[model samples]
Every structure is written in structure tokens, then in C-alpha cells.
Target: MNVAKALLSIMTLTSLTACTALPAGPSRSTGPLVIQEQGSFAAGGKVVSTPGTYDNNNPAAQGQTFHGDHLYAFYQIPQNPKPLPIVMLHGAYQSARSWETTSDGREGFQTLFLRRGFPVYLVDQPRRGRAGNSTVAATIEPTPFDQLFFDQFRIGKWPDYFDNVQFDRKPETLDQFFRSVTPNTGPYDADVISDAMAALFDKTGPGILFSHSQAGGPGWLTAIKSENVKGIVALEPGSGFIFPEGELPREMPSAAGTLTPEAVPLADFERLTRVPIVIYYGDNFPVEPTTERGQDNWRVRLAMARLWVDAINKHGGDAQLVHLPEIGIRGNTHFLMSDLNNVQIANLVSEFLEEKDLD
Candidate 1:
């Protein structure tokens, strides 16, 4: 057993080294860096507003669009010689303002990046913050069956469901409930969100996409589909249909029950990929401790990142797997970006981008 353990350890270390050795590809230019701060009357003009924090636990007001409900975003255009623009997508249940406000009362990522001359546009994802306000109250409630399932099976509870949980209440079974709530299904991937972003770009020009968790998948899809996206910074992006073979679980829930067709295989990491990608994961992010099933899910996420790194390298794309130092935080859950030490993490990101000349 000891010998076997040693071999496993060696193999894991070898794999990590191989993954990090991948070369970064040439950078693409969005032409000149043009920072446009003023709102224009162009088709897709810049819409600027004060950063607003929503209850994130309430219903939508009458006639308000989901994307407009609790939505809060801040765009900072530096006056310095044109620098690369970055678009930040918030994690689940969070507003764009959270990136600027520290839970421990420190400066936010927005100010930090802005000071460094990187113009940033922070946005709340669909069904979160200002979007889907009608379901905000549901974010705070525990599902009856979810509670029962945890009690009976002693499995860990699901992460906060937020508006998704409320939408699932009418479904007959848990499986159906899951199908009902995932964002990629309904108004989420809809043009409204994309249009809002495209308009922002029309005013601001080309930019890099930075997204976390569930928002990461959409961010990738949008970047791949839209011409305006120059690169992507995916922080623990959820599994897309184009995942590494044997890395992800076969039984995982499809995005909104719409499984990817066999004809449209998972993304190929090897080959000359168009957009550059930078991936990061929390080293201390915890696997589900209470349930084996939960742990399996966590393992899939870690494995996916490894596979993605390998594939991107083979394809001659610029991809990096960043392992953050465990800063005394037990189980690196998704919310670490909002922590006080986020500056440390952000600095690492800035360094990586600089090293690759991505900015």
C-alpha cells in the first residue's frame, strides 16, 4: 500500500508539471486601446449608472425585466494611454458591486484593477442581482425536499439555490427541479444579456471576459460566439458540453436537460485555438465533506480543470492552471473571490496576464 501511494503521488506531481509547462500562444490585439467613458447615441451605447445593491432576497417589481431587476454594474475607463478592457461577471447570487466591496471592509477588485490602468466593466449575471427579481425571495428559503434529503441521507446540503430554487418548486421531482432552474435553459443565454454586453463593447471596444462559477460557462460560450471577446479569464467555470473525455461524470445533470449532441463533441484543447484562456482554482476549496456523492461532484470540477489545461496546451493555446495558496480558509468554496485576501488572488491574476503579455 505504501509503495502504491508513492507511485500515485509521483504520477500526480508529474501531471501537474506537464500541465503548467504548456506554452502561451501569441496575443491578439483589439487594435488600439480606446477607453470611451461617455455615453454615445450609437446603436449600442454605453449605459452608466451608480453601483446599486439589491436585497437579493426579494421579488421583482411589476413590469421590470429580470436582467434589470437587481442588476448593478460599474464601468471604469482609465484616461491613460489605451489599455485592455476587461469585463467581469459576478458569481451566483452576487451583484457587481460585491467586487468593489469587501466583506472585511477592504478595497474591492474594481478599484484595484482600475488603479492598475485596466479598465473594467463589472456585471451581475442573469437570474442574479438585478435580474430575475421575482425569484429573489426564494434564494433565502431552503427547499423542503432538499432539507429532507440532507437529513435522511446525511449528505451535504446543496449550495444556496437562490432564484433557481424558487423556480423549481413547481416541478414534480428533484431531477425536474434541476432541469427547471439552470440558467443556460431559458432567458439566461437569451440575447438580452448578450445584447447588453455587446452594446457595452460597442461603446468600449474589444475586451477580455472574466467570469466565475456558473457564469463562466456562459462567458465562454459568449466569448466564442461574439467577435468582441479577445480572451477569457474563467475562475472555476462550470462544466460545458465540450469537456475532456473521462474527466467529467457521465451522470451529471445536462445544462437544462438539453444535452450536447454527439455530432458537436466537447471543445478541443489542442490545435490553434482562437481565444486565450486563463483558469484558476482555489487550492483550499473543500470537497463536499458530508457525502461521498458531493465529493464526487467536487472531484469532477478539479479533474475538468486539469484536462482543460492539457487540451489547451496540446492545441497550442495559452492556458494556465493557477493553484492559489491555502490562506487558512477551509474548503475553497466558490466565494473566495469576495474574501479580503482577494487582492492576493487578483495580484496573481495580474501577474499571469502580464507574464503572457495578455494585457
Candidate 2:
């Protein structure tokens, strides 16, 4: 009986060792993962000779012009143009090119939209992208308020500071730098962009508006002000109403030390409901509570949209909401527009445009 027991124990140990061994598979390179990396293409569908450098001589680049006071933008007019154009707006601290690249070589929003036969225009908003502080030196130095926030939050350093922050020659905290930079004239900036688009439309034609994150607020404002915008696809728009009499929840902490009564009033969004609007929310995206009260900010955002939608529908306007699943991202956060799964987002927008006959 003892001999039989010993044999069984040895068999069990062998099985455990077998399970611990790594599964056999194809060998992987030690370097970074390279997915679908491809060469850049010009607006005319011709492959540019230089990979990274913008070719000013290209007709596609020459066709568009930038306003003297406004920032320059990159555009790709399709070789085979579709009915309407599409203007893409990047989020905070990102360039017009932010939607186009991934670490694994996946095609960006520009490539996807171009392939769909639509002319794509990417803009770098004021105080951001190439138009904003482009130097590495501009990011490191923080302002007094930034330091104060850091001290309050016990944050030692900013994440991705090396890549995103612009340090000045003298000492300044992040808050000071942010305050020093001119606010882009709020909704007026959006009006100016819309005017620029109107000129583009006069030359090219009317188009669809696509905005991500914080830019969504301005894009919505722009659409409200413009007559040419056919439709809008807003991805994760920030807080909408900022007016003193607006319908913000009483629970939300007001910006700075001001009460809700003291805050600046945002324009009435319900009145501007001529075009169809689609609001997209990512289920897996994590949003930080903007206030110290730990309110569910994203929920508030959706609620605000719902309020606007209800108001719009009452007045006979078309508005829709889309919520994406959480499966695509491994550890994704609020910046869902820049994730690898953004291709799915592109596909969704394409489908919406086609269905609405706006493409």
C-alpha cells in the first residue's frame, strides 16, 4: 500500500510541473510591437516621397489656406470626393495629428476617413497643439497654482510631463502657466473657426463636424452658431452649461471659490438645434471628478446631454446617444478617442453618416 501511494504522489508532482511550463508558441521580437504601420499619402491619393515632412508643393496642401491670425492646419482632400467634408478636432494637449497614430502602427482617423472617400480637415486649436507652446522647455516649470494643487493633492510630479509639459526659462508652476496663456476667447473662438469653415465651404462646400473631448464643447458651440454644419459627432464632450442660471446640480462644487450664482453663464444650447447630433460615450473610460465633492462627473455630463436631448426633441430636433463596450481596452481611461479601438469609433461614425445620408 505504501509503494502504491508513493507512485501516485510522484505522478501528481509530474503533472504540476508540466502545467507550470510555458506554452510553446512562435518567437516574438524583443523590440516594440509593430502593427499596421504604412507610408503617408497625399490628398490626391499619391504617396508622398518624404514620410514625416509635409509637402507644401502638393496640390492637396496648396488647395487649403490658413487665416493669418489663426493657426495653420493639415488637410487631405480625397482624390474621389464624397458629398460633404469632415472636420476633426483633437482634444487638449494634442495636435491635429493626434487621431492618426498608434504605437502599434494602426491607421489613424485621417487614414480611415480618407479611405472612406471624405475630405478631412484637422485643426490645432488655440492654446494647444502646434499653435500652442510647442517647445519642450515650456512644459517643465510649474506655476504657483499648479504647485499649490500638487501640494494639496500630494502629487510629486505630473504624469507624462516630459512629453506634454512646456518649461519656461524662469520658474513657474503649472497653474500659473495655464492662467498666463490667454483663454481662446471661449465660444468666440468657436465662432471664428466656424467662420473659417464657412470660407472653406464657399470654396469647397458644407461638411460634417467631428470633435473629441474638450473640443466637443467648442464644436457644439460652433455648430450652434454655423448654418453650414450638416451633422456633429461629439466624442466625450466636457461640461456644457456654465451659466449662472444654468441647470447644473446644486451638489456640484463651483469652479474656484465661487458659488453657482457667481459663475459665468454659458450660452443656451437648446436654441441651437438645427443639425443632427450624435454623442458617443465609452463605457470603460474613467473620468476624474472635477470637483472636490467626488461627484460622478461623467454621469453629470450624460445627464446634461439628456436634458438637451429632451429639450431638442420637444422642439423636433434629432439627437442620439451611443455607448461603446469596455472590451477593447485593457486598461483604458477617459481618452477613448486616441485608443487603438478608435477604428471602431470611425466605423460607427461612418455608418451614422451613411444612414443619415450626410456622408
Candidate 3:
């Protein structure tokens, strides 16, 4: 095992290259941005309490109420913020910190978008990260699966990186990357997460929802539950494409595992059509199934995403899938938002937002 994997065995952990000539980001003055307001709040959860009398001095097993399953969000509003805020949700094994700083110690999307005049809200979903309280309890085993994720994330096979990969491969950077993988404090419940996300939207009002990896499916569910989601930007959502009940496709087989697409009521699935959505994928994905599990897994997802886009567009929805390599942006991993060319990716997203009039 490499240094990163070795360290991850003690803890637990956690990209791609871009092709083409990287485009320049929008020029901005290299000065600190002015923030009008910044703070954090918890949204969406119920209080659970035991029915019994309790004494203040003897509060061990007494009747005590617990507030659990709420999502925590931190926000920053600029002097002249955009109409809609960007609420970012992290994927599995990650927290809102994923958007704060890149593994290479660069400014992350939280600040990058804020500089673009969009109020930014980073979320820690219920039972994860800052939102650790949950109605259901769970035990998180300290399994040494860092190398497993290393392969699964498509940076490269364990202890190796794809040629021309965009990730920062310094040992220290890998250490930071590994340390970012956090365990869920409770069970992974999509309904709970979606409910919490909807609550967050309810509190923040209409805004753009950004979901990465595991949060992708729940993000869709959140939009269905709340009218506050005006737009969606998903980065490499592994699964959770909702199709009309009878239109569900056959389960796809992948080297990593079976790729299962969920079915929802026609009405619920139609909710996605109301908003403009974009999905992005990074590089190093083989066009055909590869013997490597990591590469093959993504190949299947990319194929399914194409079908998903077709379904949404057919339903009169505005959805687009951008495969970075096809567009000449190469060497991107799953975490494109934090990659070395993240600013370029940000500019791309900015253009999309402007095109859709969401900016």
C-alpha cells in the first residue's frame, strides 16, 4: 500500500485529468471579497424524547428530548448577492468541508462561487458530519477501505494515477484527501436526507442545488419535495436516476456492482422537468468496459446518464450532460469542483447559470 492508503488504514478516506486546452477563468481582482453577512443554521428535523419524568440533578435515563436528523448549513452572502444562493451537498464519506479547501490547499468552490456574487451555502446532511444526531442509531466500523475508495474514485488503481491526471499527487495532498472521508453517524436514509434537504430549501428559499456523487439521488428527491430548488448541478452522481414507473430500464451490470435505477411516480419524476439541470463527468473513463473495476463502474454510469438525459429532455425538461473529455477538458476525477482546473470548471458552470438565467 502507498503512503496514502497506509495512513487511511488508521483513519479512512477518500479525481481526474482534463483534456483540451484549459480555458481561462473569468478575470477578477485579486482582492479579498466583501461579505455582507455570514452564518450557519440547522434545518429540517424532529425532536425525539422519552416519555418519563426527569430530574435536573439526575438526568441519566430521565425523560429527555433529543433533536436529531437536522441538516447543518453554513452560508456567506456577498454585498450584492445573486438572486439565488448555491446550496452544496457532499457525497458519501464526505462532509461540507469537501467544498472549503482543495486537497492541494487551494480555494474551493465555497469561496470561488462567493466571489462570483452567488451566496454560498455548504450543507452537512443529517446523521453525517456536523449533523450527527439521528433518530436511528448506527455503529461505524473502522474498516480500512481507503485503497478501495482510491480505486473507486477513479484517480487510478491503488498506488497509481492515470496519465495526465489533474489531481494534486503530492503525499501531503493525498493525506488531506484521505482525512476528508468521514463516517455516517447513523444509517444512510434517503428519505431523511431528502426531507432535511427540502427543509434547507424551505429555509433558504428558491436556490440552485449542487449535489455530488452520493447526494445526487437525494438531491432529486429534495427538489420533488420542495419547490425551492430552482436549478440543479450534479457532479458524477453514481446512482439515483428516477424514471416513470413503467419506463424504468433494466438493471445495468457493472464490475463494481449492479447499477440500479430507481422508479418514481410519473408526477414526482416530472418535478425534475420544471428546473434546468446539468450533470458533469470527468476523464479516464473507458468507452468500453475495462477489467479495472473503477473504470468500468463509471463507464456504466456514463451510459445510464445519457439515457437519463434523453428521458428528461423528452419530458420537456432542460437537462444536459457534459462529459469533460469530449469537450477537451481532460484529466478530471470525480471531484472536479476541487480539481486543479476547478476554476475552469467553475467558469463553465457560471456560463451555464447565465445561459439559464439563474445567475
Candidate 4:
């Protein structure tokens, strides 16, 4: 009886110790655990007025100028993460701030993911937002504000801002969105954008690239350039991939000369087979689009996404296509991330990552 009692005590102690020793990680059961670190960084050189000249000025305008088109990133780390961190890329005419706050003022995807114990790297694309301006981006003219974004995003009818669905519905939400739009010159170099993003990959090991709208081009380009790109989540990746000839976007160069098909081939998306991808679209997408260029872009983008998926699968890559409404999630515009029930959408993304073992 004494020996039996002693053995029981030893077993109980071992069990308790095992429980205490467990690391703080997200489980299929409990959610995100311990957070280890969190911070922000510039993906490229910073403009310093006082790079070398700090005579009387401690920090203000020492007369240093930083180059533009450099990517900037901020990250939050959980003590235990299921997969590598996620690198979020915003679309054209916007900054990394889009992922941080909604037009309505609610928390954005950054908060949602951070709460889930996933490390998130939010980016301000080169020549946009905090990234400042650069020689490369200077040559292009300006992308005027017309119905290009308003109608194309399906936010509402052209020239009408208040009619469509919105999160805050308050007059302020509308103000907030328009305020968030960043300036751009002509067609910004997607290759330079990708290079800046690749530099980010170098700083922070391998991870996922989550891109929205116009950001998809650079997102795909970055995946091609960086081996560290484990997977990609392209949301509303422009026009339905387009409904024209069931064709996909041609590859533009990341640098001066194209080396081989393995590098930056024009139409060969097959090279991305090793990486997993998910192309997601929101409600009101043009399934049967018109021939009109603007109204028809969605059809092409949609077709682009589907074909990309098929092409990837055929080439041994894993890619999936998802429509918000088809899954019973409806009324989302191009700004789906800031939509009313973005939490639900975030859940879907999380589930996809887990399903693919990305997190």
C-alpha cells in the first residue's frame, strides 16, 4: 500500500509538470496563446535630415533624404505560432493602413490575426503611404480619381457614394476611406515593388503573402522572386482574372533582363506550383460581364483567378477559388476586409491556412 501511494504521487506530479511545460501556441482547440514580441520597421532606407550632419539638430532635418518605393512593415509575434508570419500587401491607391483600421473605425485584419496568435507583417507599398517617394516611381504621371475605383470596387454606383453598403454608415466612414487613398504615378513598377518586398522576406524569414485588390500583381511577383513565400491569399485580385479568352495576366520583368523561364517568364504561372495559393472574391462580382472595358474588368479578373487555380493544380501546386456569396457570405464590396463581418472572412482565411498547414 505504501509503494502504491508513492507511485500515484509521482504520476500526479509528472502530469502537472507536463501540463506546465506546454508552450503557448494556437491549438485546434483553444486559440492563440502567448505573444512574444511586436514592432514596426522600414523595408528600405529612411530619410534622415541628419544622416551624418548632427551638429546642433539632434534628429529634425539634418538634411538627409530617403529614397521612395521602399516597403515598410510592422509585425506582432505570438510566443508560439502555428506557421510562419503573414505578410499583408495592400492594393493600388492605398497604403498599409488599410489593414489596420476599417472605414467605420472598427479593428481591422491586423488585430484579428494578432489575436489568433499569428504574426502579421503589414506593408506600406513603395511610393505609397509612409514609404515616401522614389526616383523609380517619379517618372509616372498621376492616376486620376474617377469611377475607376468607386464603380470597379462595387462599393456603389458611379458618382454616388452614400447609396451602397458600408460599415460605419456614419458620414465619417466615407470620409475615412477617401482619406486612406494614396497617391500614385502612372503604372508603378511592380518589379521594384516586388524587390522591396523580397527584401522584407530577407529580414523576416519565410511566410505567407496576403494581398488585396491592386496589390495582387506585386504579391504574385514577390512569390516568384522569394523562396520564402510559403503561400499566398489574393483577395479580389483584380477583374475576375478577366473573362477574356479565359486568359491570365502576362508577366512583366522584375529587373532589366529576363534570365530564364524559372525567373520571370511571361505567361508561365506553372513555376509557382510548389507554393499554395487561394484566390478570393467578394459579392457583386461580374459573373457575366459586359464588353465595356471598365465594367468588364471583373469578369477577366475572375477568369484569371480560376485559370490560375487550374493551371497551378495541373502544375502540381495547390490553389483554391472562393466566392464570398457562394459560401453564404454576401454584400461584400472590393473593400471586403473592412466590410461589416470581416471577422467571418478572417475565420475562413484562418481555416484555409490550417487546412493547408500554412499555420
lDDT of 4 by residue, 90-143 (tens): 987788888987988877887778767688899988777777666543554455
- Cα lDDT, model 2, residue 147: 41
Please list the residue runs of candidate 3 whose C-alpha ends up more than 4 Å from where it truly belongs after superposition. 1-29
Candidate 3, residue 245: Cα displacement in angstroms equals 0.6
Each model's TM-score?
0.57, 0.57, 0.91, 0.74
Tens digits of lDDT, candidate 3, 238-336: 868789889888878888888888999999989999999999999988979778898888998888888898999998999999999999999998898
Q: Which TM-score value belongs to model 1?
A: 0.57
Across residues 1-359, which tens digit of lDDT does each residue of candidate 1 receive? 99999999999999989965653211212123234462222122122333444444763443333324223356767556236778887654345654664544455676666656677778765445444432222334433454433221112245433221111222243343222222211234423454555555555667777777656655655654566777778776654524445444344332123223111233532221576787766533243332344334444565566666676566667777665533332333344454435666677777767775667
lDDT of 1: 0.51
1 versus 3: better TM-score goes to: 3
- Candidate 4 at 186: error in angstroms? 8.1
The RMSD of every model to the true structure, in order and in angstroms, is 17.8, 15.0, 13.5, 7.6
Model 1 lDDT-worst window of ten: 255-264
Q: Taking the tens digit of each residue's C-alpha lDDT, what string does model 2 give over 284-334? A: 222444443112445456555555566556556788876554334232234
Instruction: Report lDDT (CA) for all predictions.
Output: 0.51, 0.52, 0.89, 0.71
How accurate locally is residue 215 in candidate 2, as Cα lDDT from 0 to 100?
Answer: 72
Model 2 RMSD in Å is 15.0
